[model samples]
Target: MDFDTIRNHYGILIVLSTFISRIIFNGFCWSYGTVIVQLKKQHLNISDTELSLIGSIGQSFGGLLAPLILFLARRYGYQLTFICSLLTCVISLFISSLIHNLHWLLITYSLPYGFANAAIFILGTLICGHYYPVNQHIKHISIMCIISTGFPIGYHIMSAWVFSSIEKNEWQIMKRHLAFIELIATCILGPIFTMKYSSNIPLEYQRPSITVTQNNNNRKSRFSLPIIVWLIGIFTTMSAVNNFLLHLESYLKYLGFASARADLWFRLHGLFDALFRLSIPLFIHLYPVNIIYLFPTCVFTGFIFLLLVFGLLYTSINALAILPIVLFSFTSAVTTSLQYTVSNQLFDKDETEQGYIYHVIITSLGLILGPIIGGSFLDLTGNYKSIMLISLMFLLISFISFSLTILLSNKKEDTHQSEQN
Candidate 1:
């Protein structure tokens, strides 16, 4: 077959690579809370608060470093870097299985695993962007959503399997099983497919003609103006706020909910998050992209839902708690997915690596800060109500920020059309 035909067939490989890679990463991502429990059990001297702190530290490190990994991928080949990341996680998992001390776990496994998780999260999106055409971004992102949604499912399965095995005194077997699965799925598949599909042409050659750099000095001047910076701040805060909802399960359990019920609520949140993420492309097709308004607007409403949940607004049924989780998760997926799509479109295809990196830096900022801010506040009050309110305020700011971005983009488009006329 001709090269175009080969590329067409290669799309399946792209999807498969993404699917397996996500599953491996998802295993680690969702395993945090479950493993935190195990660590507590293994080190009985460690307090619950201390375990939460360790997890927070690990996640904070991961979020902060995620963009740096993508930056390195820009210099080195993403294909090579991604493969190395997968292997790193595999090695970490194996070593973690052999150790018992908390300090040793933090240094050898926790730190490396944090890097592994960050690399996977950022590179998954980068790979999807690399292989797919700009027009196909939404479709491709939808596929990513489907694969990513399986993360929570994997989390539950792994948690159950590990806990059950440990109960049966089969810790070694379970650890080895997880290690082999992550290794084969990510370390093996990534290099083979990436080497096969990654382009030989450098990213600079194919990027968009317009650049943030050209606008950088102008952008800096503009930043001094309050409105533009305000918008960026609002957008950043909104991103962070939405992220807070993702960790609600831990927050709720800390608030006195039963562990089983809390986990169930968390999964329910994922189900909604996944469904909304998966459906967005279809929704974008049926409705104007402006229909994105509904998501943030619902977010504004969901804050009220949180208050109700926290203040005994409802009967306190298990299903009732699931409501806010569902709403927040759904909105989170929309914003997260939309941010990637919008960033991909901002520059020409040739500049996507930089564009993707730039947008992700914006995303990474929120990821790094959200937990620190939210977790600190939760610790201070032991009540999530204040945090929910803070999140609600940020969502409002985000709504305004997005609205302004749309306005600015529209103005630019109009000016270009008039110039052509």
Candidate 2:
């Protein structure tokens, strides 16, 4: 738990390995909308709803498989789980590139590939959580979030340089190229995960040991009314954000921007997302503010900004779309980091696995619903404005839920202190 320990050689290696692995895994996952859009234009006869369903189904399946992956990680170790995930990803991407039929593509990319994505992401989070001490968890997690921005960074750069330059017919080759890159990344970082230093030490060394009575109290508090409200907030926030992200490019296109321009806007969104994530750790350190309060504040502010921008766009001021992009990026970064750090704060060290499992399940529900709902709006109205409104409603629900949770948690704390007196 010492500061010096966190700055040691192995610590640096763990950070570097996690950075590379996350970039490879998330880069492809986030880039799916662009790929799907291209596929719909060229080869697929599917409607917007159906295409969105692909990602939803894939994510839902991945969530369903998380417990099994977690089990394997416990029994066989993270190294094997990571290796299998990487191989599955590579094979799935390769198969996706070669497949001519939509159903086969879904079978390969949406099912096994989705499972691989979740396994890799969850494993990375668990690994990083284990590698750092409790005191350093937020800082390290923020660093991981910064590293994860590489997904969008790589996606944007590649779209601008590689995908845009290629003929429209050759867009599928991007998937094959991604497969090759993942193979190389796995080959390089996979060995680092197998190193003995990557294993998690017992919680006693990581944090102060809790007595039985305190443990019981912590367990009770972990699932109390406030925590349930917070979980609901997290679920709604994730769904709202994913709905925006999944359809942002398509929305831009609908707004009359060219495909290339839309891609650039997407990249711009990534840039701001990374910046906000990088800034959060510093912000938390400088201010004596509670993240539970800060999180919902950001969500509410972003939601309001999005509503204003959407209103402006509806009035034919299309150029102001950049405002919502920036707001959404910042809010998404805050919520994403808080979701991990808050879970850490709420649960006992030994119970984090269970806490994270619940987190994943809730997050997966959002992932599954976001796109389906957004796409359904698109189908129903044949317009992007309605979808934007729906996303705003989701964010509003999240903001209210989180605000109530914070208030109830404060009330509970007050009651506990009164009892002690």
Candidate 3:
């Protein structure tokens, strides 16, 4: 089919593409924590600390290697790269099911799985940017976000079932069962969703800069160390926020709230996440286009939320515990939408997709650090306050880093325009 045919049926095609990919991405998001527990259980020698280290290793590698994968997607079509990534994850998960040895598990299963997760992140963003109209960029991203919520949502539900099965059956058997189920799901759905549209061009046609010429590729050299540092710091802050949100239940209980009541607060957190995902675009239309100012405002508000959560330990507000948690959810939603939107503004059309891959990898690494460090602080001091403090520091750093990114971005833009003159 020609571009016109696909464009004529754009609505249906975009929806299908977004839905399947988002479902797959969110499934892995949920699987991240699930695998941590399973890996620990399967390996007798791996302590909680070691498990954390393993996760960190996977995260770091994924962040660093994501650019290369994005480069590949820029060569092959996005659709093909996405299918390959889904298949790769299924294969890794299957191998993980069979591997009893720790060394083999880490080398083959865990590391690859982590890398595959990075691939999915790249694929999802690129696919969205490639297939949808550029003018509708934020709308498409928000639509994906709407679909992406299914990832965490499905993860929670499916993991519950998996855990129940794990309790009843041997670990190996449970692993095999889940693996086959995932494999079948990917094998059937991956091909169907990917091949549906024939007009999809090779990555070369889509993004020729990477291989266009040596000089052209030079323009795409990696960011400077200082910039990389800034990106990493922003990622670390986002990671801390992710950790606090994920562990809000334990944080509340530590602050003297009842387990049931604390759990209720967490459910509300999920509700706000879904609501924010749905609502951000609506709000985005009304917001000023001052990406510079608006982006920092999100950082500031999110930072304040982090502080409130941390302060709760000392103040222990029984009447208003729910408010900060709600703010946390809102902040995550807004920050997430803004992150993509700001990233969209920062890079050109050709550069935006790959930049997104880099961003996700960095952000995922931050996520890895957040929980590991948060858990350590809790285990060492028997308090959640330290975690909150760490989160606050990370967010402050993010606020600064984002400010620098904008400054650097604007300076670069001005320099380019002057040279053109």
Candidate 4:
């Protein structure tokens, strides 16, 4: 695994291409919350809970389909898998744009579109991992995060320019336009994957050993109970974030901000999110802190900030919303990046893929639940404050669970050392 050769051959082109593809994919998937808000305003018959269910169904279905997509990637290669997925997305979006019935929209948007987006994301991640050197995996993951800052950036762009420009009742027109843009982008970028260099370089290039270990018992199964507990923490924390993102715009509207103004705040939140992710690699390069310590600290801090946001909402203080948004965005950004890095640290290469699958499944559960719970709270209370309170509780539980994981890990290390003595 010659690092220089791989770097020279592919350079940044691969990263840029994948970034563009992800931006296109996430731009639509993540921005659907804003679209849903618009849709609800125009189609007064559909309840918030129903709309949230549609979004949840898409995310949960995507999770359910991830293993199959991974298998397809393994069998047919990422290029072909991506092409097929993108085609499905294009068709799904087109169909969704024409739908007036909520049930029909659910079938087209929630199932095929969501599945394709998840497939593209997972395959893109695996492809990126394959291309980079073993030693540079963290750097690779960070860069991918930095590129994924595009997710929020894309949201901001769409919210500020595209969604804001449209008439309140013409949300479907916007969906149709988005479908056209996605169709063109897919056609142009899908073929790039067909090139020979697009395939993974080779398995031999992977690192010979794990870089991080919890104890002398390196033979421990990646699926051990401790790891499972840690994953539960991950799942809970991700659910909190997903819930926050889904409801943030609507919450702002509930707070009485105009749609355009609410979107501006959303865009600002994304800017901070991008900054946090982009700074992670540089922070590691400079500090070289132990991730085990750093990861939990970030999680706990974000939850605390979330508590503050809840307090602010309770007080009806609109001017200081930015503070919590920045805090939450920073926490969300770190969690998203570290989930990959920590997974790599915890598992052997052979087991990493399985770990990712489990992570996605757990995350999908959170994604599914976040909306339903939030929507239910909204429907029952006619406000988002209760949702915030629930999210705070979720984060608190995750913090305790992760803290226990660290403690148990240390206990295992102590036992391992005593046994050797």
lDDT of each: 0.59, 0.73, 0.60, 0.72
Candidate 3 displacement at residue 386 in angstroms = 2.8
Question: Which ranges in model 1 have alpha carbons more than 4 Å from their true place?
Answer: 38-53, 56-63, 66-68, 74-76, 103-105, 137-141, 147-177, 198-247, 254-256, 290-298, 301-305, 311-318, 345-350, 384-390, 411-421
Alpha-carbon RMSD, candidate 4: 4.4
Each model's backbone clash number: 5, 0, 3, 0
Each model's TM-score, in the order given?
0.79, 0.89, 0.76, 0.89
Instruction: Give each prediction's root-mean-square deviation over alpha carbons.
Output: 4.4, 3.6, 4.6, 4.4
At residue 270, what lDDT does model 1 achieve?
A: 58
Local accuracy of candidate 3 as per-residue lDDT tens digits, 219-255: 5544654357457656866676666754555456556
lDDT of model 1 at position 52? 47
Give, for candidate 4, the lowest lDDT window spanning 10 residues: 198-207
lDDT of 1 by residue, 158-275 (tens): 5555555565664445666778888778656776556355444335322476677866754453343333533364345544543454356556665777767766666566567667
Model 3 lDDT-worst window of ten? 193-202
Ranking by lDDT: 2, 4, 3, 1
lDDT of 2 by residue, 199-257 (tens): 45422222356688976786786788877888888788878877887787788777778
Off by over 4 Å in 4: 1-7, 198-220, 314-316
Candidate 2 stretches with Cα past 4 Å from truth are: 1-7, 58-61, 141-144, 158-162, 165-169, 198-222
In Å, residue 313's CA in model 4 sits off its true spot by 2.9
